[model samples]
Target: MLHNFAGNIEMYGILDAIASGPIEALTSENSTMVGVGMSMEGIEQNPIVYDLMSEMAFQHKKVDVKAWIELYIARRYGRSSPLIRDAWNILYHTVYNCTDEAYEKNRDVIVAFPDVNPSLISSPLEMYPHYGKPTSRRAILREKKNAYEQPHLWYSTSEVIKALELFIASGKELSASNTYGYDLVDLTRQSLAKYANELFLKIIDAYKFKDVDKVTSLSQKFLDLVEDMDTLLACHDGFLLGPWLESAKQLAQNEEEEKQFEWNARTQITMWFDNTEEEASLLRDYGNKYWSGLLRDYYGPRAAVYFKILIESVENGEDFRLHKWRREWIKLTNNWQSSRKLFQVKSSGNAVSISRSLYNKYLRSES
Candidate 1:
């Protein structure tokens, strides 16, 4: 979103002065331009320059002024002409070079400024104030509050659903004519995988579910689904789930209580199931019979064959094959949930069965 305005010498002078020292020197055109250029060039070379540019181009309200300033600076330095084109190039390269990292760093900004187009630069004055000084602490605080209050700052359940809707609507177009649709599908899938594996764990901890064992079992199933989709659910461990888990850990009254919860959730599902006959019977029926059949029907004939293998292995007490099928099931479940496509179906039960069947099919073919 860099503007690079060629014609505004005075504005450039003011920019230069602001860059060089205090706002007081902004009165002189020559000094301002020089100050602005020096400051801008320095910004351009920063490791985070691309991120800052993305913020300006894709997120900020004062992009027009920023664009103008960028153009003015670029033109003054004879770096490039047609500031819009330069801006486009900058944007393209930034996206291309950083790839997913760019999105991670500037997702909040991009979502906030979804309508941004680098080609829309008409005036420098429109782009200037966003980079300038604040009048009061109250104004700064207001801006911060506004930023935190923005609805699209983080991926919410609604946004995830919308992304899925786009994926389903695009349908065959994604695989055939529409490259953008395909990209959207891929991006949405990636985002969902991240959310499922990372954010999901946080939700479990936050809610402190009484049926901790059931939660753990469900979580494992979800993870399995991810693997079945042939997608990696791993995020930058330090930045993703780690922060949420750490926050949850901090919330616990004592380490012993935290360990107790973790043990109950992760290791006691089977024991809990044994104690609850009705729930156990329902799970067994659903997991072994109903869901298994549903999976075969949902994924198609090839997948049905795989489900048959899994059933046979389990029924005949073939430990190795049973183990293999179990692993494959987990992987498929993870993939299905991670895609965020499960919501398209009305029934969670039906979705689970379908996912299991598809995964079974994938495994049989791979084997």
Candidate 2:
């Protein structure tokens, strides 16, 4: 499987570092490695990213990432421009160059907290949000791990933000073309995700401080960010939640079987291996998603509970018992689901145009 961002590059020359294989192996005796495999999981799901990587399976010559990405955008949108190529060139040197600690550094605490530091057996409320004694929570771990992986620990956020702006500007030029619509969405998703990651900390901090008003405001604002995401994704089926849900339903012989398969699909993005019994359930929500249906229905509800409890606790001058509510949240999600009771799947507008408009409206509204 191909590797992705592991850590931040605090110093120059790290971009050249990932591609060089050991000289010993490259020059050594017979090697039988024909090709490589890629697990699409834990990836951005951008066809271009995966497509280019797949192209490498057959590429023999040592390819430069800049040139390779240039060829990709040229072929991808049925047009080529220096702006396009250069935007990707910057991407390669920024987010695309994330260190191995990248994933761990950018871990989403709201969804991935339960398994942040897994135990052989996790107790109820064992990992619930609390401020007092320092625990081995992902939030805690992230604070330590981040120091080694960001602007100082990883890539400069300002630079990545600029690259995103450039990519978005190029996307506006191809507003009428369908060939690269999904690609544009992928770029837009990455841009918005960057903004969201920055907001995550502020949201959690409000919760930690029991700042009820701030938590209520930020929680709703956070949910709206995903809603904005769902709107962008509705432009194409590639990002729609319907296909994933439908695939699970199609393989089922009946409603019960459908529910079973649906549960796994829904569970995968939500509770993950959320079984209260298994140790490996430690991986719960590791691959959490913000798809149309999941974001509007599942994630939004989970967050609303916290917002409600926190705000109410602040008003009542009492501590919020996270244990009681977390169990209810678990019970609410522990099932196979079907329905778009939240967002649409069919295309209703031009994907690229939406990107150009929303890129400024939502993702950069913070500016």
Task: State which candidate has the highest lDDT.
Answer: 2
Model 1 C-alpha lDDT per residue in residues 2-52, reported as the tens digit of each score:
321211100011222122232334434665322222223112122223333
Q: Whole-model lDDT, candidate 1?
A: 0.29
User: Where's the lowest-lDDT run of ten residues in candidate 2?
Assistant: 115-124
How close to the true structure is residue 299 of candidate 1, measured as C-alpha lDDT?
Answer: 25
Per-residue alpha-carbon lDDT of candidate 2 for residues 1-367, written as tens digits (9 for 90 to 100): 4443322111112333333332223445896554556653355453554565566555555557676677777677778777767766776776566443433323443333322111121222222233222133445345444221121124444555555566667765765566567656766765666555555556556655667788678777877877777677677666666766678768999989887786666666655554553232544455565455666666666666656666677678776656655665666566323332324546666776777777777656433
How does model 2 fare in lDDT? 0.55
lDDT of each: 0.29, 0.55
TM-score of each: 0.26, 0.74
In order, what is each prediction's RMSD in angstroms? Answer: 21.8, 7.3
Q: How big is the positional error of residue 50 in model 1, measured in Å on the Cα after superposition?
A: 7.9
Given candidate 1, what's the lDDT at residue 187?
34
Any runs in candidate 2 off by more than 4 Å, and if so which? 2-25, 28-35, 39-44, 100-106, 109-153, 207-210, 272-281, 335-345, 365-367
**TM-score of candidate 2 against the unseen true structure:** 0.74
Q: Per-residue lDDT for 171 in model 2? A: 63
